[model samples]
Target: MDPTLAIPLLGGLSPAAFMRRHWQKKPCLIRQAIPGVKPPLSRTELFALAERDDVETRLMLQRQGAWELRHGPFTRRQIPALNQPGWTLLIQGLDLQVPAAHALLQQFRFVPEARLDDLMISYASDGGGVGAHLDSYDVFLLQVSGRRRWRVGPVKDATLVPDMPVKLLANFEPTEEWVLEPGDMLYLPPRWGHDGVAEGPDCMTCSIGFRTPTPTEMAREVLQRMIDALEAPEKEPHYRDPAQTATATPGLIPEALQTFTQKAVIAALNDSRSLACALGETLTEPKAIVWFEGGEALAPGQGLRLDMRSKMMYDADHVFINGESFRAAGRDARLMRQLADQRALSAQECAGLSPGARELVEEWALSGWMHGV
Candidate 1:
C-alpha cells in the first residue's frame, strides 16, 4: 500500500496525511467510506463464530434501564430473540478466524504492524448498545449493515457507573451526533467518549482497533522478555567480601551487594542490541490462545506467505516471528524484511535465499507460522 496515495478508505486523505492530521489527534467521520460495503460475515456466520470456545465474545442487554452482561460460548437459544430490543452480541478478533475479515483489516496498512491489533464485530438488535464509554486505544468504527446512531465527544469526566459488569461513563455528554448508514465510518483517538445505539434490527459494525501500550505495561513486558532471553555466562561470578568487617545489623542490605546488583543489571542493559531484539520478539508474540499445528516442510521453488494468525515484525538488526528473534543481515535481511512488510514472498524471492535462510524458511513452514503460497 502506498502511504501517499489517497483512498476512499480514509475519505480521500492519503494514509500519510491521515496519520499526520487525525491519528491519535481527533475524530474524522466519513460518509460512504467503503461505498456499498457489506458485512464480511452474515448474521448466522457471526453467531456460529460466537459459539466457538476459541473466540472471545460478549452479550449485553439493557432492559428497563437495567444493564446485564454475559460471557459466551453461547448457543442460539442463549442469545436474545431477534425482535428483542436493547440487546447486542459482540465478537472479538474476527480477523483471527475469518480470511475475509483479515483482508479487510489489511486495508489499514498505513499504521505500523506493531501497533495494528485486531477487528471486532458487533451485532445489535434495535436500541442495543454498550452504553457510553471510553477506550484507551485508537479505533475505526465502520457501519457494515443497517443503521447506528453515534454520540461522541472528548471525555472530561473519567468517572464510571458503580457496580456495572462493563465500564460505563457515569455522566456522558455528546458534543456531536450522527446517524450512520452502511459504508459510513468514524475514526476516534484514545480516551474519546463515544456511545453508539442500533437504530433497527440487524445493525452490524466492524471495529478496527490499534494496540496502545502504556509505558509501565510496555516496560514490564519487554524487560521480562529481555531477562528470559539472557544467555548463561561461561563462568558464574560469585560475590566475595574478602575485606569484610563484622556488622551489627545483619538484616540490612550490604552496600557491596547493592552495588553489585546495580552493576549486574547495568551490565545486562549495556548490551544495547539485546533490548531491540527483545522488543522485536515481544511485538510479534502471538495471542495467548493461538496455537499452530505442525506441517510438512516447504517444497523447493514454492512461493511463501505468512499464516493469517502469525505475528511477524523486524527491527534494525533482528527479524521476529512467532515470538522468536533471529539476527539478519545483507541479502537475507533484505528478503526477510520484505516478507515482513508484504506478508508474502514470490517463488523467485524464495529461490534467491541462501541455503541456511532457505532451511530456516522451511523450519517456519513446518512450524505452521507460514505456508507455501
Candidate 2:
C-alpha cells in the first residue's frame, strides 16, 4: 500500500495521513470500508470452528442483568438459538486458521507486522454483547454481518465490576455512538472504552487487533530469547571464597559472586548482533497453539510461499522465521528479507538464492515453514 494513496479503508485518508491524524490517537468510523463484504465464514462454518478443540473460543450471555461467560469446544446445543437474545460467540486468531481471515488482516499492513496481531471474530445473537470494556491494544472492528450499535469513548474511570468473569466497566461514559452495518468499520486506539451490542440476529464483527507490549514486557521477552545467544556459563569458574574471613552473617550473598553475575550479564548484553538476532527471533515466534503440517522439499521449478502459520521477520544481519534465526548477508539477505516482507518469492527469485541458502529453504519446506507455490 502506498503511503500517499487515498483509500476508503481509512475514510479516504492516505496511509501516511491516517497514521499521522488518527492512528493511536482517536476513534475513526468508516462507512462501507469494505463495500458488499461477505463474512469470512458462514454461521455454520463459524459454529463448526468453535467446536474444534484446537481453536480458542468463548460463549457469553447477558441474561436477567447478569453476564455469563463460557469456554468452548461447544456442542451445537450449547449455542443459543438464532432467534435468541443476548448471547455471543468469540473465536480468537481466525487469521491463524483461515485464509480469508488472513487476507483481511493483510489489508492493515500499513502498520508494521511486528505490531500486528490477529483477527478475532465475534458472532452474536440479537441484543448480545460482552459488555463495555477497555482494551490495552489498538483495534479495528469491521462489521461483516447484520448490524451492531457501538458506544465508544476515552476511559476516565477504569473501575470494573468486582469478581466478574470478564471485565465490565462500572462507569462507562460514551461520547460517541454509531450503528455499524455490514461493511462498516471502526478503529479505536489503545485503552479506549467501547461496547457493541448486536442490533439484530447473526451479527458478526472482525477485530484486527495490534499488540502493544510495554517496555517491561518487551524486555522480559527479549531477555528470555537473548539467553540463547549468551556464552556457556559452564566455562566460568564456580563460586569460591578461598580467602574468606569468617563472618556471622552466613546468609548474605558474597559481593564477589554478585560481581561475577553482573559481569556475565554485561558481556552477553554487549553482543549487539546477537541482541538483534534474539529480538527478531522473539518477534517472529509463532503462538503456542500454531502448528504446521510437514511436507517434502521444494521441487526444482516451484516458487515458495510462507505457510499461514509461519511468522517471518528480519533485521540488519539476520532473518528469523518460526522462532528460528539465521545470519543473512548480501544477495541472500536481500532475497530472504523480500520473502519475509512479501510472504512469497517467485521461481526466478528462488533461483537467485545461494546454494547454502537454497538448501536451508528446502529444509524449511520439508519442515512446513514454507511450501512450494
Candidate 3:
C-alpha cells in the first residue's frame, strides 16, 4: 500500500498525511471512506458464525437499567429475534475466521502491523450498546450495517460505573456526535470516551482496534525472551569473583554479582539480532482464540502464501511467524520478507526461491500456515 496515495478509504487524505496529522493524536471522521461498501456478512451469516465452537463470541443484553454479559458458542435458535430490544452479539477476531473479513481488514494496511490488531463485529438491536465507555487502545469504528448514533469526546474523569458488567464511563461528556450509516467510519484515539446506541434493529459495526503495549508488558515480554535465549547452566556464563574477599554477611547479594547481572542484562538487550528476534516473535503471536486447519504440503516450484489467519512479520535479519523466530539471509531472506509484507508470493516468485527456502515454504504449507500459490 502506498502511504502517499489519497485513497477513498482514507476520505481523500493520504495515509501518510493522516498518520502525521491525526493518528493517535486526535479523532477523524471519514464519510463514505468505503464507497458503496456493504457488510461482509449478513445478520443471518453472523449468527451462523457465532454458533460455531471455533469462533469467539460474546452476548450482551441491557434491560431496565441492568446489563448482562455471556460467552458464546451459540446456536442460531439461541440468538434473540430481530424484534428483540437491547441485545448485542459480538464476535472477536472476525478477520482470522472469515476471508471477506480478513480482506476488509487489509484496507487499513496503512497502519503498522504492530499497532493493527483485529476486526471485531458487533451486532446490536434497537437502543442496544455496551454503554458509554473509553478504551485504552485506538479504534476505528466502521458502520457496516444499519445506523448507529455515536457521541464521543475526551473524558476528564475516566471512572467506571460501579457493579456494572461493562466498564461504562461514570460521567460521559460528549463534545461531538454523529449518526453513522453504512461505509461511514469514526476513528478514536486511545482513552477517548465514546458511546454508540443502535438507532434501529440489525445494526452491525466493525471495530478495527490497535494494540497498545504498556511499558511493563513490553519489559516483561523482552525479559522473558532474554531468559529463553540463555542456554543451560553449563553453557551459560557464571559470575566469577576469585579475587573478592568474603564479607561478614556473605549470604547477601554481592555488589560485584549485582554489577555483573546488570551488565549481563544490558548486554542481552544490546544484542541487535536478539532484540529484533524477540520483538518479531512477540508481534507475530496469534491471539489465544486463534487456531488453524492442517493442509497438504506445497508442490515443488509452487508459489507460496500465508494463511489469512496467520500473522507474520520480519526485521532485517530475522523472520517471525506465529510467535516463532528464524534467522534469515540473502536473496531467499528478501523473498521471505516480501512474502511477509505482501502476504503471498506469485508463481514466478516462488519458482525463484532457493531449494532450502522452497522446503521451508512446503513445511509452512503442511502446517496450514501457508498455501500453494
Clashing pairs in 1: none
Per-model TM-score versus the true fold: 0.98, 0.96, 0.94
Best by lDDT: 1
| lDDT comparing candidate 2 with the true structure | 0.92
Per-residue lDDT of candidate 2, residues 1-373 (tens digit): 6889999888888999989989899999999999999999999999999989989999998899799899998989999899989999999999988899998888898998899889999999999999999999999999999999999999999999988899999999999999999999999999999999999899999999999999998888899888856676567677677878898999998898898789877988888887888788889888888887888889998899988888998888889998889999999999999998889999999999999999999999999899998
lDDT of each: 0.93, 0.92, 0.88
TM-score winner among the candidates?
1
Ranking by lDDT: 1, 2, 3
Candidate 2 lDDT at 265 equals 78
Q: Rank order by TM-score, top first?
A: 1, 2, 3
Q: After superposition, how far is residue 340 of candidate 2 from its true place, in Å?
A: 0.9
Clashing pairs in 3: none
TM-score head-to-head 1 vs 3, winner: 1
Worst-scoring 10-residue span by lDDT in model 1: 294-303
